[model samples]
Target: MLDPELVERITARRAELDELEEQLAEQLAEVRAERDELAVAERVLERIARQLAE
Candidate 1:
């Protein structure tokens, strides 16, 4: 038998944590997209250099 106030507090904290988790997930996705874009740029540069060498 839990106190109603305590249960309410716990529920509030869980919601806050859920929001933070969603924000972190979004940030992670942004970082991964940036990394992928950089990788693609590097490959393009390498290909251009190789073409100039021929």
Candidate 2:
């Protein structure tokens, strides 16, 4: 069995961890969006190069 103080501390720490997890998820989503945009740009560049070659 845990003491009251320890239980309170654990609860606080869990809340902090949850907030950090949310922040990390938002950052990951931004990174994924940037990566997807880059991929599209790469495909467009490749198409332009092929057109130029022909």
Number of the top lDDT candidate: 1
The candidate that achieves the highest TM-score relative to the unseen native structure: 2
Q: Which residue pairs in model 1 clash with each other?
A: none
lDDT of 1 at 38: 100
Tens digits of per-residue lDDT, candidate 2, 1-51, equal 779999999999999999999999999999999999999999999999999
Predict model 2's lDDT versus the native: 0.99
Model 1 lDDT vs. the true structure?
1.00
Q: Compose the digit string of candidate 1's lDDT tens values, residues 1-54.
A: 989999999999999999999999999999999999999999999999999999
Instruction: Please give the lDDT score at residue 2 for candidate 2.
Output: 75
Candidate 2 lDDT at 14 equals 100
Off by over 4 Å in 2: none
Cα distance off (Å), candidate 2, residue 26: 0.4
